[model samples]
Target: MTSTILNPYLEGNFAPVPDEVSVGDLPVTGTLPRELNGRYLRVGPNPTGPAATDVNHHWFAAHGMVHGVRLRDGRAEWYRNRFVQGDAPNHSPNTNILAHGGRLLALVEGGRPPVSIAPDLNRMATWDCDGALRGGVTAHPKIDPASGELHSVTYLLRPGSEHLRYVVIDATGKATHTAELPVPGVPLVHDMALTDTRVVVLDLPVTLSMAAAARVASGTPESGGEFPMRWTEEHPSRVGVLPRGGTAEQLRWFDAPRCYVFHVLNAYDNPDGSITMDVCRYDTVFRDEYRGPADVLPALARWTIDPARGTVSEQIMSDHSVEWPRIGPELVGRPHRYGWFGGIGADGLHLSDDVNRVRGGSLEPGPLVKFDTTTGEISTHHFGIGRVTQEPAFVPRPGAEAEDDGWILSVVHDAATDHSELVVLDAADVEADPIARVHLPRRVPFGFHGNWIADNDIGE
Candidate 1:
């Protein structure tokens, strides 16, 4: 067996911890907000045992592990870490964690159902939304702030399947609607955008490639072994728009350039019969090979879909590479001006070719970025060298009036000390130092999305 120490994904902060831990009353560097009471929970991939050299593991193929910190009464409380229990063969739920229908679900994009977990991180049964879900659910489901409904476009990787399912779960956590939409190939729809009146679906050039899958099965050295999908020039890149309450027959497909979007900032309907969406656009992904970091970087871009003309217009919003775009929860499916993201800073410490050659080598997420859509200005908070940050979740302060009036919560990993800290910064002034830094017992590996579940929001 080849030691995982040579695999970039299993080394450093990306390495999986050996055991789960529970601690209380963690130490803090600054004052915690008295009004803020919630659990800051994050989920990511953590392999169960030693990584297999012959298995061709992808960074995303590991088991799911969750880390959480409780905050209340202006003080740091408990911190707990646990593995998400599920029935899937791999049982890796490392993607996004969110609350819906009063239940907390750990979600992965495809292949497996979501696993419900308790507020204290105890694993529950696998959730199928009362068997309403026909296939795997998307990790990025848009919850309408006004209607309290959840919407998603889910796909199944089963052979001989050529359709995607559009699902809507009611506020009470019941699957109300499911529609099958036909497509040419099994394209990866990692995320989608929602507006007041429509749902935006992305069908990019990256699709399941049998040739790539065969190469991986044969253990070809150049094959990005874990994921069998790859970018193909033959695939037609397009975007589809569907009515909020309508079916596949009413869906209109619009042509888009050859690019990919991993996450959308927000989308809203325009009075002129057009829709505007902000997203982190990558020039290409899963292209030549998927062994390591993408050769292309993603930047914020605005896409305007004109249904009448059947065309989509795109304009770059920023030049810097960024992802995990987020806005206030209240602004979902509505117009918003401010957005936040995590990206590589100006220092460019992790982008070198050498780093990109190894899997998960570029794990250092450099800075937290704030984008002002109203004025086209970009502000950032750089955490300096050797300190990496994860996705920033915006927590609105009590009685907050402005959209940006909140605290940005992120888990920062310090390589110098091999420890992690929950850093909180006022969203209004992101360039300033963090308002509070809650120390953690161990490093939280690079992971996907997380949320701040308020005390009042957790189910009793």
Candidate 2:
């Protein structure tokens, strides 16, 4: 292993691709399903040049890019990658991408509002539900399939920012409800969860650093390039629960473990009035290192929150190192059977040795893992040592009934060739070979969350 203390985010598949290219007729090694006639869009940060050479140079904050592939009637039509154009302050939304309310949105946390991009992968303007949305949004919002509405719990990631916003937008691109819920401190509310009856807010331990904020304000040589958020014991880790469409006055806070959760797998309201949440739990992040993720990796855990008794019971479903968890698109705010995740570390998010020989890398991910939440069963698919797999998104088969009846799509990077491919694996048989692989001409850097936007869903 390379023992050098290099920023792992800037090397290997985590490295950014220069310039944008549009290529047609990408080669395919297997047959493309005729029913799959939509664009598979994956996005991540791709710095225009080199990132800042400072301690604050983090993977979370960088220029955004969206790589897209179009499929029509089982034929690979085209592939394109474009830099998401944004010059406004706090508008660099380089985290996640999805289609909602008949529009495409590139998302980020904090005061940066979601930016609207065209279906062709070009930059547009900062969107706000046609003025129904009054403020910023979250990258990880849940879309209700039954009602065709979007529910989000967003917060301002600024120094001394002390409140969270809960916004609900309807199917017609209009905000129906919005409220500001108060929190104790400037916690890093990266992700949130939802159920049919209530919204789950993760008021965890990671909060803004006033010292780091001073560094940012000064712009001095001593404090150049610093990410402002860090883990803090001063801020208690609490899970705030509130009824759907309710105000901050109704929010009931429940105490939780001193942990951080970047992504929530799925949540549901039990018949007994308790909320069940499955999440990727991290022991701590941004503790020792201020740049990006380090220390202990995340494990799959389930938290049972009982508002009636004001208690939460935490259980580890598995201790495997993993991140970027996903369920069936329609299963948001509902119970789910299967969850797909991207693996990390040797087992996941742990130091390989006492010498600490490695940092985080795109090559460190182990497999595309599938967990049966009901039976405590696990299955995984690896693309070998050098070929790293990012998040696996599940696209359900058209008119499918079974929850696991879908194709798991992911972007896999091959280090030997320095290129990426969109691999389609059968969710029923995840350990099997890819059902289809669409080859790209160049490498796609390992980044963040994405989804398969069916033409029908977006009215293409």
Q: Residue-pair clashes per candidate, as listed?
A: 0, 3
Candidate 2 wrongly placed segments (more than 4 Å):
1-3, 50-56, 87-90, 132-134, 221-224, 346-363
For model 1, the superposed segments whose C-alpha errors exceed 4 Å read 1-5, 50-55, 214-225, 345-363
TM-score of 2: 0.95
Q: Write the per-residue lDDT of candidate 2 for residues 1-460, one digit (tens) a residue.
A: 8565466677777778888999999899898888888899888887654363443367776778898989888888889998886547545678899988888888887777788888877656788776654367888988888898888888786766779989999887789998889986778888888898888999999988888888878977666456788899788888988888889999989899889889999999999999999998878888876666665657789999998899999998875667889999889999898999987743334333331423442225657888899998888887776777869999989899999998998988887899989999998889999999999989888788788988876755
- List model 1 lDDT by residue over 92-141, tens digit each: 57889999888888999765678888998865668888776637789899
Q: What would the TM-scores of all predictions be?
A: 0.93, 0.95
RMSD of each: 3.2, 2.2
Where's the lowest-lDDT run of ten residues in candidate 1? 346-355
Candidate maximizing TM-score: 2
